[model samples]
Target: MKCINNEFLSADTYKLLKLAKAKAKDINYKYAWVHKGMVYMKKNDDSSKIIIRIEDDPTCMSSNLKFLSLNVNSYTAHTASFELLVTETKPHIISVVETWLNPEISVSLNDYSAIRRDRGFTDESGRYVRGGGVLCFIHKSLKSKVLFISESNHINHPEFIIADVTLSTGSHMLISCIYRRPQGDLLDKFFLEFGKLYPHYNNVLIMGDLNCNLLKSDRASNHLKSFIDDSALFCVPFGSTFHTLETDSWLDVIILVSKDKLVNFSKSKPPFIDGHDFLICEYKLGSQNHYNKVVKFRDFRNCNHQALSQTLNERLRLTDIDPEMIDLDELVYFFLYQVTTSLNIYAPMSERKICRPKCPWITRELKLEFHERDALYKRYKRTGCQNLFSLYKIKRKELKIKLMKVRNDYLKSFLENESNGSNIWTKLRRVGIVKSKQSSPLDHFDADQLNKFYANILKKHLSCSRDFILNLPHLYSKKVNFEFNWSKIDIVDVTKNLQLTLQKSSGKNPDRLDLKWLKDHIPQVSLFLNLIFNRSLETGSFPEAWKSTKVMILGSNRKLKSLANIVLPQIIIDGNLIPYVNTTKHLGVHLSANLSWDFHISQFLRRLFTEEDPEIRRSDRLAAKNNISFKMPNFATTTYEHSFVVTAIRLWKDLPPEIVNVLSLETFKVKLFDFLISNE
Candidate 1:
């Protein structure tokens, strides 16, 4: 028998070997192989019921049986080359043999020579030189009775072989053996194919040299993202596994299915090969003998076993500690009580949701009150004040003095005014001002009031001084820090001089009066003047001196009179006229000429006619007396007499359509006023 490529051994295997040696006398075995040809044995263990066998080869029957018997039985069995072939009679024995060899060598052992007896390998030039194929076997297990074989035929494509282990537990396992190309687009094709293949398996355990890093590749990441979008399977949380000593990257994984079943499984460190690590999983198969049995296996030895167990324990602990199962309302109430007690305040009612009374405000209030209470309690405790009332009085007196300073500072502006007095009555009045209220006389004159009389005396003196300074124009101006010297001349005289200077500069013409300039130089004064003039006009009480002068002086300046006639007439009429009259007719002819022709025609007609009917002879005589042209009518046949026809025809021919429309509209009151006034 030959076994090849035995490279590594585990520490537990050594212990097992030692145990085998100690039991060697019972087995009566002479020797056993440790690894590929490194054999050791005890001469006395030939009769041993169990034996230790370790080898890398799968085709050797002796080695395979020894490996199986060690796991199935306790006693050591030493055999040099024992072979017991059984037909149907010893089926159990045959079953055991089959179990051992089936897992170990089914995929690896091939009778290719039988199929190609005359074939030989080809030389470099393609002539036949040698004819053989590479073969390898893989075993994957996920759950009970879930096992599979992956075989590489001719060192190329790996084919998954289904086993006939029908599980009573209704569990199915998936196994995929991937032998990737060295470099190509083959990875994309492999993943595309795997996505289609994955849905068929219930429990998948894929293992092999996939030659692909799932983490570093974008396509792999995207595929994993898609896989996780469904919550059925979860990836294990081992950081990295393979390529232990290589600097580039590690963890070419053997992915598992029904991942929640193996949730606590993890990878072992210090790879099986020095440069390639493998995962160890501790999975719960099912309940056995009324207790859970965790099956742990690792592809690597000499790795941390405790980590795997710890991972399992943590997962169990998390499941046990999940807080979602607790009653949340009770938890919230308890937390509320905790916060309220810490704050030394009552918790807010559950119905109130704005700013909760149980918030940081309560905490801050408690902190402040505690500081105050601590000081008072210390003082009362030191003073030996027996009654609560007496202790409170003491604390209140102390607090009152401290708080009085704060109140004084708050009212310092009102108190510091020279006109005000710092006394009970004045303080009450000051408080009223702060509260925005009126003062009372009893607040000053009460006999029991502290400093009441003095406060009243001071207030009276302040009132008199205020009035005196107000009456004194110089002092009033001084108070406002104005440069005007009121004592040098009467304030009225100074104002009159300023007005006269303005009027002279304005040249008795409203058009030349720079209202903007007046506003800039003396905004308050100008505003006051305008207000007075407007109010007088509105009340029909405008002083005849100003009004007459305004009209006459404005009429003297053609530009001023034109502006006043057009703009100011409307302003005055809109402001004061209960039943307005035509002011434009009152305007001089030069002002009337500036009016629109509609005003000229309407004014002329109103002035010319007063009654509905007129004597033709009288109209004709009047037209002749006014030096206006007239035409006499020959009314021998009709009662209607046509007189003043020449004047009427002349006026009708001169009137424009705009003038006609203006005369026709009854609501055109301003137009009527302008026309009548201009005609007058």
Candidate 2:
């Protein structure tokens, strides 16, 4: 170590700082120790002096931490792929470099919150640099804030985005995403800024595509090598990240230096296929925020539906234990017991931790195709064969098409069959058509607070509802159709309605009323449910479990943070003016203003307004595109043959393009029959 003076440090035009409890700490001045994001190295340099910072003895305050670093050339263009990465993969912090974003361009992900620094800022020459930027996508559940952003006047200066994220144990971790151009002398510039920021935060993780490959013997590589001399920080020993036909190099790196131990870690292959293979490190940071609810789920894929049906049919012999032979309640109870017992034997519930969003659309075939494409790419990269590269590109394009088709098919099937507004919105939200804002940090309101606030307004109505027996008799006295009445609805009708209800999982359910289980065993449960419902109505009593039919009080709420800036004039009723508050509750719905209520219910109102009588024959299957004229299966001797064949061909032609291209005659026949039966 040289004398702690200006001349020693001024030897380089740029510099960086680092972490170490070394003998060089005995120095004065704020910029006393040289920062360590860069280095200088020669081939013959002494190997013993190169202080490796792997921290063989682990020390850490965090319980669970995972980071994914990628050099996404442009995040905006690849957002759909990136969304899959963030949601499917469990990463606490996602660091992306080379985002190629600008101020006017907006990027939003459903569950992950983004902090981006675009390279639009002017350099020393007063011209904006075209294509380098850095960003971090922190999971929404974590408490985080932007700590610093690097804005150097030099055009070739390294770009950085720094964030301090708080773990569940309330320990803060400084995350930095850095990106540097492959230019000259910028190593010093990068480390100079990084050096100044490193000392303040103890728990630090630096990730980026810094363009200086440490494996190479060059001036920039030497600079990085010298930077690693400090004992506190270490770059992960990752193999060649950036891959091409003729070259493979470690241009991307994850450099971490923290006081806490992070020894228990693992890496994963990134979901997306790109030139730069992403670096994923799953770290045991600290205590994890236990938010994911452990739910009991039966693997229906393994369950034999036919066996379940046969068992139920054999067990419920109506003649032996018929309604005439036994009491209604006893018969119902017996049927329920038999059904539940059969289900228990067939599809028993097993506890599973939800690690990712449910993507049932990602069928086994699609997943296999995805893996095969990845394999092709990896093989092409390894062998550098032109034919393999061509095949990889073809597979990649085909896979993209299939992915889109599968997702669209999932949505189509859902929307066509399910009409429940809440379930529809839930699906849309999950699929990301609806924007999901991060849960507000400032929200302190709870159920009790809301209840107390509403109680005050309710006090004025206390005098209006004292006599319930006299007022409640009108509903019982009025005559109603026997089929539609609550006292004696048909079991068939109840079962039909239940079929339309979306399947939902339940937790802490004492009665074990999982909607999925009920739906799966619907045929067996219909008679039992009908009997119970009729019994309840006849007895003028409600089952406690069924009382939960009321809408959940904590209905989905839109993020209120965006409404903070909205200020409206006071409402004047007669001569008195009523002051406006931040949130106004109308019929249990939180809204910003009176006019917002209009916007809130506008969809419903629009439907009502535009409700002209639709045509009885709404479907134009015959008019759809590529309406092929079908040969009558060599039996076009009657009107039935002409109408049926033509209609079937039209429908087949109108199917999704990929589906039409690959559909077999047998599948088309089966689909056509089903369509005819459904329409009938």
Candidate 3:
């Protein structure tokens, strides 16, 4: 039997191992069941009546308030690894520096909402200075509100992102994620900015990769020390060596005010996604949010469908129908109530935990490989052996390859299963596979420029010209060959069609209603839609809500516009000419005005648009020429692969001709998009 020492294991694993060893001895067992880095030793042979209890380990306990900070050199390559760590660790808040994220590439995680201040702001010359960004990821359950900071107030602006947090305990915490470049006078300016903000928050946490070596008693270090002294901030001592990388110097640091407010401050091994180690801390500031399990009356696999139909029929018979007409809203509400009540009576409510599932791709082999890689890294760090370091690097590369394979396998299986009609959508909702965006380079225009550009677009495309509108009556009187029957649109058929087209799980619409809720109450919604259509036909007018238009801006060379102007002679939304953007999402396929795929490429090659960055280009050249052994940033790697165009075309080709040819443009846009996106 092989014996593993506690030195190589994590604190939690060590405690579990000790308990397992004792239990195995008590049961006189020669071996223990080891699976996925956990030891499952039976206490007795009678498995059914076995005594199962272990002492509570503080290291294994979940923290009410947890924070993780990492100096990710570039987040593009390591987003999957970072998400895995965050999911497993279950941190409440995460701070990342040197993110190198841009508007084109989205790094948003499922359970986490991102607040990113990316680098590469274009100057007057339309050139970019690309390399420093700060970002933060807060769990959606935290209910954290980000406070906007005015960057113009500071004369010397260092890269930083600050957020004011109101914890569950009702305590206030100010978190600042910063990145200080090791250049001229920037560190001094950072210290000044820090001093100015330190006095504002009572419980402040300052985390960053401040490139100054604290071990060296230099002027910058001394100044940092002076600021720490003045601000009454306590710099937590690293439990291990201060160095995070192979440089033998410490760069990453964490400083916080109020020692009593924090606990369990420690550093993790290098995550292998980046060169820097992850700093983890837990602060008991506020009460934990009470996650009350919502009781939903969902149909189970063995639900009595026959009984449900019979009960609904009997209930409908019991109701006395009036000969006179009722209000449209009342009729719709009563129909929904009947359907919902019948379903609830047939299928009782069940309490399900609102927990995100683990990544389906994370296999036991992957866990063992990750553990082995971390062990090798620790050994190399301890012994400083060239051979050990070489082996570690090899293992690191192999681990990356393994991760890519697992992700690819997962994606392949997911798409295949979903295409063949599988209930894998529930898991897909929790861990949606993030794909790199594929499109042409967006335009670089300021807010004023974009407003002007979109105003013109709206006028040309959306609004009718004066001459065209004046001639509309003449054209309208000349009836076309097309004819329609409003009565043929059965309410039940429309309801079923809408329900079939809905996404399994997605965010709320502008009306603040989820697809699932709409599906369950589709009859009422369909009746309401029927009433609205009839009313529109009778009065030749649409509802105010239906008239509101939300514009989505896409295409090449687009800037991050705050607001778009729309001024037309005949356009009005909600009794106003200037309509606001209701909802904006970043994902689409581009087509020319003539509906030709001429400009669109099959592959979303990230390298195509990024070739202009000198830093990235230079790094890639150096790595190729010298066969660099160190970890390269995301930009240095030339392995960008995406088959979005191929998959999309294949899916579209698979659709039946009858369905494809008959679907209207608006219907295809909403329903086809939902189907493709949900499957993806």
Candidate 4:
């Protein structure tokens, strides 16, 4: 964006200029773009700058109710054509087989998540082989968990991926994308393992280039019919999906097993270059979640905990029945109600609406260009006009190249400036490379089935009886006189234990009442607890409510898992190799082998003193023999301790006493500041 002539502008500079350009056409000069130290008209150079506007929910998000299956010969090569297709159709789930991709090559689509199992093979004879990979692209509106089974040494396994997807409306679909070699193999073993990966009752959607041409009578189709349950329906329309000069075979297929009937099925030429056509089929799905874009959270930044605490105290004091006389559960309920009630009145849930346009870089003008190009392609196809076909090809090529550039520019600036609640890790997740387990949504199961699964898991523990322990032989002890009176227990001890509990509440599920509010009214809560405990002791029965706790399961791992270099077993600490039960945390930072924030902090301090004329304020505490003093500013809270004024003053105060004392610039400012802060 060289404003001198608007020529010879670099890609990044042009992108940065567009970030500052006007969103709408206006004569009042509200927005302007700067380039090469000069301001210019914010209009796009070639076309009208058409902004991509998004609603609370986009039409494409709801319009996509179909699943598209294609046989992409080489995904890496056909990415350009495939991306344009995604932009147009916006299918909910896209399945690809024969990607001819390895683990090194990654495929990604914006707003759609990719689950892939690249072809794995060994070339022992110095030979090369290709053409077997399975991939599924699920929209971000759905939640997907992938289960990949690694290749086994003894068997030539089929390339397949099981992706359990939960729709926005909470309904689940188990999509399995598979790719089999055209050559015949043992279908029994492959199907057996595939069945074991997913539950039997799952609403299954099986799609891929199975190499089973239904045109001719074949055993492969029969095997599929037998394996898929009675409810299973073959959705691929009768046609030659794959075409050649001499022969056309219906190799690509889709088999769905669900109670709901199929809504529609249609076929279209793949946006990519392939012999196989796209098999697009739509199924009835549950309602889309309207509130998905509205994020909910509590805005605690402006809340006053002290006032909330006082209100809770007043409510607790006004309870109709005395806590000491009421049942223990009743007392506990009343106490929790008062605290949570006050908190809700102070700080409540707030929502921020997020509008993410599917293709923000593809402005209205670009969309028109696409339509015009498509029209040219149709006209050329209808007629035998070489010139028209050539023009269409040229336009298509230009649009593809422009799309890649515009998308890159828009995303680069969007990621930098957009305040959407996403972070670096979220962006990484979008790449779909991180190997970790995610909870699979319930596939074709009801609430009772889920409850039964958990029940079966906990049956052994819950069914354990006390009869054996009661009848077991035990050593008898001499009777000892001990005073067991809860009435004499000091309220301070109760408050201390309660405060300790609150302090350890970190990493646990958030409670209804904020810990700040609870800690604020420690005495009042302690009084209620003390009364319940003393009464429980007198009655010799603990309230069931006291034993209640929340449990969140992060995947089942009762059996040991192999770390293999993915994680370290032991670490050298204090000249010893000590084994740890789990990862260790320091403050709010995760300590890793490569680096941590501590390393960066140390580097900052080192450069501050070691480098001449450094950017930082230059007095280091460890660099001098005695602490120095300087003009200091007092911070009201620890939140401001790292601010420039505070850190600069603290470092300046660390200078030598003689230099600090003799200085006319507020001699002994640290002491004066400390006195003033203490008095305040």
lDDT of each: 0.34, 0.58, 0.56, 0.57
Sorted by lDDT (best first), the order is: 2, 4, 3, 1
lDDT of 3 at 239: 32
TM-scores for all candidates?
0.22, 0.33, 0.32, 0.34
> Candidate 1 or 3, higher lDDT?
3
lDDT of 3 by residue, 1-680 (tens): 22334344544465567676776677675444445556565534554322223333322433346778887778886778787877777777788887877667677787677887777566668755556778888766455665543253231356777777765445567777777766424455555655666667777877777766677778767777777887788876653323444555566777778677677777776444445678888775543444344544465556676666566555554236541264434543555566667666766456776544457788898899999989998998678998999999999998899898988988787777675233455455446544234332123334344344444443443422335423333332211122222343467766766776684445334332234633544543565455544544433333333322332233233322421343312323223233222222221222322222221221122322234453333333332343432232232122211223233334656665543664465666576666667778
lDDT of 2 by residue, 1-680 (tens): 32122332321212222223232344311222232522222123242223323222111213556788888788888888777876666677889888888887888776678898888876579766568888888877577898678776455778887778776566677777888887834566557666776777756788888888777978777777678666277677776788778887778888777434555443444424467787787565555444464877776767888898788778875545545455544654575578778888888878988655567789898889989988988798678888998998999998889888988898899889987777677777666577556442124444335444543443333222214312322222211111111226798877887786634422234245556665666786676567666655443334434332221111113423433464433333223333333233211222222212111211111122234442211112222222322222221121132234334444544454443443475664576566567777
**Against the hidden true structure, what lDDT does model 4 obtain?**
0.57
- Candidate 3: C-alpha lDDT: 0.56
Best by TM-score: 4
Off by over 4 Å in 2: 1-296, 300-338, 351-373, 376-424, 432-443, 446-448, 462-487, 490-511, 515-523, 549-680
Candidate closer to the true structure by TM-score (higher is better), 3 or 4: 4
What is the overall TM-score of model 4 with all chains considered together?
A: 0.34
Error of 3 at 636 (Å): 90
Task: Give the lowest summed-lDDT range of ten residues in model 2.
Answer: 595-604
